[model samples]
Target chain A: MAKKQLPYVIGCDGGGTGCRVVLADAQGQVLARASGGPANATSDFALTITSLSAALAEAAAQTGLSPQALRASVAHFGLAGVVSPAVAAQVAAALPFDHITVTSDREVAVTGALGGADGVLLAIGTGTIVAAQRAGQRRDAGGWGLQLSDQASGGWLGRALLEQVLLCHDGLHPHSDLTRATLADFGAPLDMVLFAAQAQPADYARFAPQVIAAAQAGDAVGRGLMQRGAAYLDLALKAVGFMPDEVLCLTGGIGPHYAAYLAAPAQAAITAARGSGLDGALWLALATARGLRGGAA
Target chain B: MAKKQLPYVIGCDGGGTGCRVVLADAQGQVLARASGGPANATSDFALTITSLSAALAEAAAQTGLSPQALRASVAHFGLAGVVSPAVAAQVAAALPFDHITVTSDREVAVTGALGGADGVLLAIGTGTIVAAQRAGQRRDAGGWGLQLSDQASGGWLGRALLEQVLLCHDGLHPHSDLTRATLADFGAPLDMVLFAAQAQPADYARFAPQVIAAAQAGDAVGRGLMQRGAAYLDLALKAVGFMPDEVLCLTGGIGPHYAAYLAAPAQAAITAARGSGLDGALWLALATARGLRGGAA
Candidate 1:
């Protein structure tokens, strides 16, 4: 009797800070998982490709599969900086798979959360971006960047906290416990604020947890920033035509926390995605594999 | 021969908004300014007051002199809100003065411009408010209001025109020539925007010019709301101490325009005799009476 072919797929999710890869079978069981360094394809394509490759190799090693064997398998990538067609092609070229597909990290997250339904997905982690999928079309709202936009992201919160500290140092605002703690973390003279803000968005986002803690401890400045941040997200939701009963998915680290602050309309619209970028990638991989079978036949 | 006491001193300058008044002498000055709807206080307060107030008493009419004569007369007032405690009080209480003295309207202008000399000022009109002056003290930088805070000012050009319109439209942010023209005129959907944003600080500010123009165009939405209308002035300049520049001054509108914006700031900051409220009021009236000072005391 002929041996039966195993049904498995490979998936990758890449971001500015890191890349994650997962190997899974048809039963939705993860066989192997691996992580690596930054993989934002737009800003640093070579480094992103290298990290993605290493992560895939690490996952394959766990499965005891050679590079050649993995190359013949189906795979999908959910990657940052893949908004442009040229960038998407570059990401696709980096991955080794018989059938591979690439899409924006935002698109993958939306697909994973809503099962490819029509709704808005507010992905706010280290950075913030709002993407709306309606009637098979997509539109982007905020997420200009750390400097000009991204009004409700972790980075924005950090920047606002730093601004409050600087304002206090300049005697332009009242000094508060949160400002004191923030100044202590960064050291005296307070001129370092300009330097701190010069870092990339993800670097700034890492400081958001401290701000959240400060807010919870009754820091009016911190609390105000959070409220403003949530309000910014609400504005984005309004831009996307968020219906009261629509299944709006909240993704990323800060999304869950910010979800609590959303109004009844937004709350009723809220639903957490069952799968993340990895799951979406895996789904794409399986779909690609099915397409390959039909094409070959 | 004994010198006759000039009991009344009147100072007036009118421009694109309304007329202003200052009644003072060498010893001290009192102020009374009235809004004539849309008369320019920077150019002709004399004519504007005719329409604003029921009747003008000639004794202190043109020179801000009181109907009753007093000794030693000096009247000066910069057209717009200049920094001065006396000026602020006069504007606030509508008090007529003898021996009235006013300084650069810019001084009281800062109170209204920065919302009360404790935050950044971004006054945008024909000019801007990028000035970084601290209250009652000299700093390394003071950009002269319109010349400096232009970054945040409506007169800053570039993105500001677009931002005003976009912010007005529920943050939908559509860019078009029609939108730009509508923003310049402060009409239509813009009227709705101004009404809806009456409570928000940024929104109130964004819609102020719209309200001003609507009143100019004889629209009902703009005419009847004076106190709330003035509150927009208070809100925009409210964050004076939010940064190192804790004092602001105005560069737009006419003399009485500054009065509306400065009323709250003067009440909050002027608790003593030697405050900017009085000083600015005296300075504005004096500046207007520069040529007519006769002889120094």
Candidate 2:
């Protein structure tokens, strides 16, 4: 005897910071949304599994569905650090769902920004990644990772701000509120050096918001950091082949804020995402389920 | 009585990288010169003892004397990261020498650069620091640490080179031998990200020589990094109250190479170091010896 399969679909957008999930019915009607801890399968498989499970349970709980019933449903995942196909397959296979699909977080971001249409996206946060899609052909630039690229991201911006504080302390640059705050926070340059000696990109990213706040308050150093970040973002967009006619979307934690500082033309072309990344994941999950049911998406 | 105190003087210049020692006769004539591994007394007391022991043994061996003979001599210890008086006393007590005088590595560098006279020094290396001695009043600028200052240091220049490499990879800057080498060394930006996630300042400083070499070969990126480093050095010098006709001695592992890039007047004022930091430590040791003997120096 065949047990009844639930008509549930789940979409996940995961990264080093955390994960977001959306649950929907077979008809693509959104039913619930939830959040979870970070999920980077490549870095820690067990942690990613635990986080995804909690997120899934939360989503399932919203709809009064048991975990067993949800396991029979279809699922789609968009995650960071899924750079290799092997890892992608491994992550997909690790999931509890009967049917599964997995792709890069950038794909979900682009899909979310353009609402399944053709366009480009400049997403900024703890990191930056540029993605473009034209007529079903997609290309990505930047997001080479925080060290070699993602120059305009929150992590990069924070590092630059700290450097500015150091430069100011050295008298290579003038002091500002931003630099003062940084010095106060670190107590001294040695403290900052100690912090940098061990700080990860996520740790550095914590300072980005303070830099932005100081910039908005008219601190010269802070404004300079933002301007520099904007310029890098522009360069990244051009490098990724952003076109004039295509609708461009700036998405992510710091994306909308950064858009305000972009060049006038780029500013004019900027548009908000049509749907969230979780929404895009939900759409993909629905499309996958339709394929399984032998129906048009 | 007093072990007929050996008529000897030992001068030590110790830092995080390596240690230099000089053994001299009662007349202050050098009898030997030797080097040893890094000796940071406060952090690793045992390792410091071992390194200083080997260095002293080598110095004594050059004079055909035993280590026990050298132990009765007056010793001057100028070391890096020896910031507190308590630590200084502890290090002095730990050494085998009967009379011990401990100072900072910077003190030796300044005294060495100035030859015990009144002048200013611009020292550049893995880090940058400027010291000025005028009428017995000394002032220091820069070298707050790599995080807060050290604007034009080898570490700073290396970081600039890496950023330039990333910029080139993003097409925001042009390609050059420097960028190509960087990419080849790291395998890609992703690899670089992983490296940065764990790299220390010394790790970054390792690339500075390569950058300088490429610059000497007329690579634009290389030239730019040197020029920027020089400008920062200039700022550091000015901040420390460098004066005209002050016999501005540029000293350190990479100092002289940077002098060629300084402004004309500043370059003209530059002079060769009268002696090495080891010589300064020796001079101080001689003073200590005279004081112990109840004689005027």
Candidate 3:
């Protein structure tokens, strides 16, 4: 039997904190977007499916589509904690969509940031990673996940700021605005026990905004933490063989905040991402639907 | 009901990692010493009691004391993660003892470091805190636990080393012996995720020895981390009103390693702790048994 081209597609960005689903027509025009609860496939596969289903329902509702129609749409999932191929297959099998592709959030992050073009996308939110596309060949330098590395990410910055606060806790270095503010935020040194005792990557990342704010306020320690994080990002770009003059997109929550601290040459190379990870996922799904795998726009 | 001196006393130092019990006489003479499993009271009060009991039994076995005899002995516990009086009371009440007193691990840390004399102790192991004894008045500056603050501790140093390794992951900073050693230990960045994802304070602290060893070998990054930690220790000491020529004992696992990094004046003031936390517990137990509270030797 011959198949008719699906009229729409769905792009999913599933993370530990929450999930985002985007619905678009075959022409890559957005139809609807929605959000749902967490979908960390590694820790809870059932929850991932449930979250995806909920998010899909919301998107379909927004687009005035029926459940069966939406189910027929091609879908692409860029999820956190989806590191292994086996897990990806399991997720794909569990998903209700007729045609679907699942990959690391990093992949869609790069695709979305670069809009299927050959360039680099450095995602530095709760976690960190650098992904680049050149002549349709893509490679990643970091983002092994939060356990191993996420160098210049928000979580990394929060962790680094915490270390700085503890380092200054001794007054071995002069107390700076950063330390004072951090201590004030977390309260007494003793109060920090509960925070660190139960802190996840997102918990640590929660302090990134504060660190950024402090840096902007001329806090020496804050600036140091910011610059250090940026340096790591810079290193990640270089590690992936990022050449000057090539387009580079700094993606994620804290990615853009680091621009000012990057080297002049690299800074000059930086540019806005052509689209969001949703756009990238949609493009991936559309391309895959046509049997054009890893074919960049 | 005239007061009678107890025949024996038990001094306990219980932390997240392990429990130490020392059995002593009313005269503060050490009789038996033993170790047992972890006993973080805040995490699991029942487990704490079990571990403490196990440690106490070992100490009793060493002295050939029966269970009933040991239960008759007054027990003074210095336990980690017992931040509130309520928790302490709960722990004390759960113990199978005729009489019991519960205080923080920091208290015995100071007592052990100062040997009951008026002085200050900076404990930097898996956590950080400073306790000062002056004019029979005891004051503390830190040791809030790993969450709140533990500046210059093994955990802090380990965390710093991890940051350095991540930073040097980009080779932004030159590869030093410290980074080399850390990478070799963790294998690759990918392996670090499992470590960070599952790491407790002790897990991060495990790298402290490697960092120290690297520093001794003249690794620039290692020395930087060590020196930074020492500075915090100095700050902690100063924060607690450390006076020149006053006996300041540096305690804990990484306590001694930071000595060289301390400033000249502070280093000059640093002295060897007269006893261990067990000894301090014994001293405190004896003092309390005699109705002398917080009184220096």
Candidate 2 Cα errors over 4 Å, as ranges:
A1-10, A15-17, A22-104, A281-297, B2-4, B7-104, B185-187, B281-297
> Fnat of the models, one by one?
0.03, 0.50, 0.36
Model 2 TM-score relative to the real fold: 0.82
Please give the lDDT score at residue A83 for candidate 2: 65
Q: Number of clashing pairs, model 2?
A: 0
Q: After TM-score superposition, what is the CA distance of residue B91 in candidate 3 from its true location, in Å?
A: 1.8
RMSD of each: 15.2, 4.4, 4.1
Per-residue C-alpha lDDT of model 1 across residues B1-297, encoded as one tens digit per residue = 677544334444322233444445544555444333322232233443353243234333555543444234444433443323543444423423444444334444444344334433333443323334555442321112221121222222223333334443545554344345655565554243334322212223444465455545654334433334344334434434323223334345321343443455433442211233324444544554454445534
Question: What docking grade does candidate 2 earn?
Answer: acceptable
Q: How close to the true structure is residue A269 of candidate 1, measured as C-alpha lDDT?
A: 78
Comparing 1 with 3 on lDDT, the higher-scoring candidate is 3
DockQ of each: 0.03, 0.36, 0.34
Q: For residues B158-250, write the lDDT of model 2, one tens digit per residue.
A: 777887777787666789988898889888776775576455455677888998889899999999999988887777778777767778988
TM-score of candidate 2's A chain against the true A chain: 0.91
Question: On TM-score, who's better, 2 or 3?
Answer: 3
Worst 10 residues of 1 chain B by lDDT: B141-150
Clash totals for all candidate models: 99, 0, 13
